[model samples]
Target: MARPGPRDGALRPARRRTVELVLVLTALGAFALCLAMAGLQIDGRVPERFPLYVGVVSAAALGLHVTLRLVAPWADPLPLPLATLLNGVGLTVIWGLHHVRGTDTNEADRQLAWTVIGTVLCCAVLLVVRRPQRLQRYPYLAAAGGLVLILLPMLPVIGIEVFGARRWIGIGDFTVQPSEFASILLIVFLAAYLGLKREVLGTAARQLRLGRVKIFSLPRMRDLGPMTAAWGVAILLLVGTRDLGTSLVLFSVFLAMLYTATGRKSWVGIGLAMFSVGATAAYLMFWHVRQRVAIWLDPFGPDVYTEHGGSYQLVQGLFALADGGLFGTGFGQGRASEIFASDSDLILISIGEKLGLTGLVAVILSLLLLAERGFRIALGSRDVFTKLMLTGFAFLLAFQVFVVLGGVTRLIPLTGLTTPFLAAGGSSLIANWIGLGLWLRVSDSARRPAVLPLPTPAEHATVTMRLSGAHTRAAENGRNGEVSSNTRATPQG
Candidate 1:
C-alpha cells in the first residue's frame, strides 16, 4: 500500500465559529429589542440605561465568542447564544419589575455585574480545563468537594436561612448558594465514576425470562452501592437543609445520569421508588415539605393562603398568569411584581405575566434547544467519559428546567431552585455559565479531529521499500500471466 501524503488524516478547522458569531449577533439584537420594549411599555420610553445594558451584553457576548474561537473553535455554538438571550430576558424582567414595584432594587445592575462575572468564569473554565479527561483522575476528590459544598449551608456562622431554607451561606455581605456549584461537581464525580465502572454497573446478573425470550434485565444487589449513596446524599439534602429544589435537582440528575451510564431501566425505577420514599418521609417528618405540598394542593384555601408563608405568593403568581392570558400584557405592563419572589422563585410566572404563553414557550424552547445541543455533542463524542459528562450536564439543565416549571405550574410542590440563566441569583448564574464552559471544553475535545503523527524518516523509508517490493512482485506476476496467456492461446487451436 502507498504511504499516505501529508494531507491525509490532517485536522481541518470546522470554523463553525463564524456561524456562532452570526447567531450571537442575532440574539443580541433580539435582546436589545426586548429591553427597549420592556422600558417603553412601562416608563413610556426606552430604559435610561438602555445603551449601557446593550453595550454590556454585547461586550460580554462577543467576548465569549472570541474566547470560543481562540480556545474551543469546534465547540457547539447554540448554548452561548441561548444563554445570552435568557440572561438578557432575566435582566429585562428584573429591571422592568423594579419600576413596577416602585422600589430601589439595584437588581439589574447587580445582575449585569454577575453576568460579567459569570462570563469571565466561563472563559476561565474554557481556558483552564483544556482536557476534560484529566477530570476522570480525581473523582473522589470531586465527590468530596461536592459533599462539602452541599453541606456548607448547614454550618453555623457562614450559613444563612432564607425563606425557611438553609441553602445559602454568607461571607459578610456576599451570600452564595453552594449547592448550585456543588451540583456540577457531583455530576462530574458521577460521570467519572460511572464511566469507569459502567461495565460492572450496567451488567445485569439476573434476567426475567419468558420461555425462549429474555424479557428484562435487573440490577445486581451489590451494584446498588453507588445508587444508594446518591439516594443518601439526596435524602440528606432534603431533610438537612429543607431545600427541596436542590435535593430534587441533585438526585434526579443523578438518577438520569445513572440510567444513561448504565442503560438500565431498573435503576431508574429503583431511583424513582427511593425518591418517593424519601419525599414521603420528608413530608411526614418536615413541616416545610408538608407546607409546600399543602400550598401546591390548595393555594386558594383561606386556611392556606391567609397563613404566613402560605400560598399567597402562589395565588398571586396564578393571578398574574391569568391576567396575561394567551397573549401577554406586554413587557413591563403586568402585575407580576406583586407576587413574592417574582424575580427568582416565581420567575416563570413573571415571564408568563409579561410575555404570556407564547413568550414563555419561546423561552422554554430555547432551553430545550440548548439541552438538545448538549445531547448532540454527547452523541458526537468518542470517549465514554466525555459522553457521560456531557450527558450529565445536559440532564442537569433539562431536569432543572422541568423542576422549576413543574413547581410554578403546581404540577409539583414548589421548591427554591432558580431558573438557570433566567433567575436573579448570582451563584446560580455563575455556576450554570461555568457548566456551559465545561460543555464547550469537552465538546472541543470531542469534535476536534484527531491527528495521527507522521512516521519518522526510517519508518517512511521502510514503508516505501515495502511498497516498492510489492510493486516489483506484482510486475513479475503480470509478466508471467502475459507469457502464460500467449503460450496457452496456441494450444487452444
Candidate 2:
C-alpha cells in the first residue's frame, strides 16, 4: 500500500468551530437550567421573565460566538464557553438574590445591561486586535496609559469614594473602576518590556558564595531599577486609593511576568519580601489596613462584628456558607442577601450558600480550565511578547480568584476584589471580557498552521530542464561507455 503524502496530512478537518458551537450550546443550556431552577425555588414555578432573560442571554452568547467564528476561527474554544457559563450563572444568582430579598434596587437589571455591554466590548476588542503582537509596538504608550488610568480615580472632581476606597470615577450616575482596565494595559507594557529585557534581568550580576559554594545569583542594583520603580508605583497606588486588591493584583501580575520572562527565582523572593514589608508597614500605619486585619482575625467577636464598618458582612457570609453543607440550601432558598454587598464583594459566599461545596468546586474548576487554556496558549506561542502577555493574564486571573475566594473563606483579609465573571460589576465584567478576547486572538495565532511558499514557475522549469539534461547525459554515457569527459558534468550548478 502507498503511504499518504504531506498534502493528505494537511487536509485534516478544522473542527474547532464545530466544537466551540457545541460547547456554547451546552453552556447556554446550563445557564437556562440555573435560571429555571432559581425560578422554581423562588416562586414554585418558572418565572414569567425566564424566557425573556434566556432569550437575551442566548442572543448575546450566539453573537459573541459568531464573532469568534468570523474573526478567530482557530482560537481555543473553551475560554468563551467557560466565560459564558460563568457569566450566565452569575446573572442567575443575582436575579435569584434580588427577587428573593425583595430589594428595591435593580442590581440584577444593571448586571444584565453590563453583561450586554461587556459582550459588545469583547467583540469590539476582537475586531480591533487582529494580531496580538501588534500591541508590542507601544510598550511605553501602554505603560503611560495604564498609569494614567490607575491614577484617574484620584482626581478630586471625578473621584468617588465608596466604602472608604477611592477607586471609582463617577460619570453621570455611572461609576467606572479605572484600575480594572489599567491592569490589562499594565500587563501589556510589562510583557513587551520584559520580553525585550529578559536577558539582562536574567543575568547574575553578583553571586553569593559560602565556603566556595555558590548560594544564589542576584541581579545588579542597577538592573533592579525597573522592579523597584514598579514596587514604588504599586505602593503609591495602594496608598493613594487605599485599594489593596488592585495593588496586590497589579504587583502580583508584574512579578509573575518578570519571573516568567527571566526565569529567575530571585525576583520572586525579592518581590515577596518587598510585599511582606510593605504590608506590615501598611498594617501598622493605616487604620483601614489594621481594621481589615482585625476583621480577618476576629470576625465573630461582638465588638468587631458590631463596630461601625465592621465585620458584619464577613460574619454573615461565614454563617451563610456554614448553613450550606455538602449540597447547599439550593438556588433562591438561602438568605445570602443578609450580607451587604452579597452580589458584588460577597458573590462567592452567595454561590456557596446556594450551590454548596459541590457547585463551588465546579465553578472553581471551570476557572482553572480557563487559566489552563491560557497557559497552553502561552506555551504554544512563538513570540516572546505573546508568551509573556498570556502568562501575565493567566496569573492575573488566578491571583484575582485566589484573593476573592480566600477573603470569602477567611483565608485572607478582604481585599474588595470582585470575582471575575461571577461578581456584579460593570468595569470588571467589561475588562475581563476584553482580556478574554485578547486570549482568543493569541490562541488563534498559536494554533494557526504555517503557510509554505510555493515554488515559482521559473524555478520549476529550471528543475525540469536539469532533470532532462541528466537523463540525456545518462543515456549518452550508456551508449558511449561513459566517455563524457568533454561535457564537463554540465557544471552541476
Candidate 3:
C-alpha cells in the first residue's frame, strides 16, 4: 500500500483539468455566438451593457467549474454541459425578450446570477459527498425530507398560493421550489433503496403464466410497501396543493428507477396499470386534474379559459413555436413579445418560435446525445454504485426533457418542473449541475484500470504503452496475462 506519489496524484488530474478547461472555453464560445446573433437581430448594436457583463460572468463561472471539476473529474459530465446549453439558451431568449420589451438590464441578468450561485453550490456538493454509496446511510431520512419539502407550502404560516398552485416556498426576495430540491433527494433515496433491495424484490415475486408467456415474480406486493407509500404522498400533495406536475414527474421517476434496478418488464406493466388507475381516480376526484386533461386533449377547446384565462400561457407558447416555423425568426426577430410568462416553463416554446424547428430539433437531439453519453459512462464504469448513480442521473435528465417538451407540445398535461438547467429556477440550476458532477465522477472511474493490485515495476514497464491511455500493451498481451486496464485515447494535453 504505497501512497500515490505527489506527481502521480497531481499529473492525471492536471491533464483531465485541461480537458475541463477546454470544455469551459467551448461554452464561452457558444455564448459569444449567441450574443453575436442577438446583436445582429438588434440592428448590429449589441445590448452593449448586458451582453458584455453576461459574457464575463459566464466565463468566470465556467472557469470556477473547470477548477472544481479537476478536483473531482469523475463527476457527472452530461449534466454540466446540458445545463450550460439550456441556461445559455434561457439567457439568450430572455435577453431577446427584454430587447423587444425595451427593458433596461434584461431578465438574463437575474438568471446569470443564479447560474453563478448554482455552480458554486455544485462544487460544494462534490466537496461534501466523496462517494455516492454513502448516500444510502440515510435513505429513509432523505425520503422524509423530500416529503417535508413537498408539503412545506401546505402550512398556512408561510405559504403563498400563485396561479392556483402553492408550489413555491419563499425566503425573503428569493423564491425556492422546495419540491424541485426534494425531487433529487427522493431520487437518491430511491436509487439507494432499489439498488439494495433489487435481489430480494426480484426473488420474492412468484412467477406467473398468462396466455402465451410466463412472467417471473414482479416485486409488486413486496414493493407495495414503498410504492404505496409514494403513491399516498403524491395523492396527498395533489389533494392539498394540487401540484399535478410534480406528482406525475415524481411517480414516473420512481417507477422508471424500479424497472431499471430490477430489469423487469413486469414492473413496467404493473407501473402502467397503477398509473392508469391513479390517473382515472385523480381525474374523477380533482377538477384541476380534469381541467389539465381537457387542455391536453384540446388546447384550443372553447370550454377552457382563453386569452385572459388558464389557456393563455400554452396558447402564447404555441403561437411563438408556430411563428418560428423552420429556422426561427433569425434569432431575436421573432414575435414572442405577446407571450406573457414565456421565459420560465414554456421557454422551449419561445425557443421553438425563435430558433424554429431546426433549433427545437437540435435541442432535443442534444439532450438525447447527452443521455446516451451518460449511459455509456455508466456502462463502462466498474463500480456498481457509480454505475447506478450515473444511470439514475441519465434517467433524471431523459425524463425531465420528455416531461417538459411533452407539456409544451400538448402531448401531456403540463408539469411544473422547470426544464432542467434551462428554465429560470435556482434549485433546478444547482441540482442539474450536481447531477452532472456525479456522472463525471462515474465516467472518470470507468477510465481507470479495472483489475485489483498493480504489479511490480518490471511488469508495469511491459505495459507502459497501454498505461498511456491506449491499450497497446493490452493488445500485445493477447494470450498473455489478465488485462487489468481498459484504455481508450483520452486527450492528455
How does candidate 3 fare on TM-score? 0.83
lDDT of 3 at 465: 50
TM-score of each: 0.91, 0.92, 0.83
For model 3, state the Cα shift of residue 65 in Å: 4.6
Candidate number that wins on lDDT, 2 or 3: 2
Q: Which ranges in model 1 have alpha carbons more than 4 Å from their true place?
A: 1-15, 209-216, 465-493
Q: TM-score for model 2?
A: 0.92
Question: Model 3, 308-416: lDDT tens per residue?
Answer: 7666677767777888898888655666766666777877887788788998897788788788888888788665555666677777788888988999888888876
RMSD of 3: 11.5
Ranking by TM-score: 2, 1, 3
Q: What local distance difference test score does each model get?
A: 0.87, 0.87, 0.71
In model 2, where do residues sit more than 4 Å from their true spots?
Answer: 1-13, 211-214, 456-481, 484-493
Alpha-carbon shift of residue 478 in model 1 (angstroms)? 9.2
20-94 per-residue lDDT for model 1 (tens digits): 888899999989999999878988899889999999989999999999988888788788899999999999888
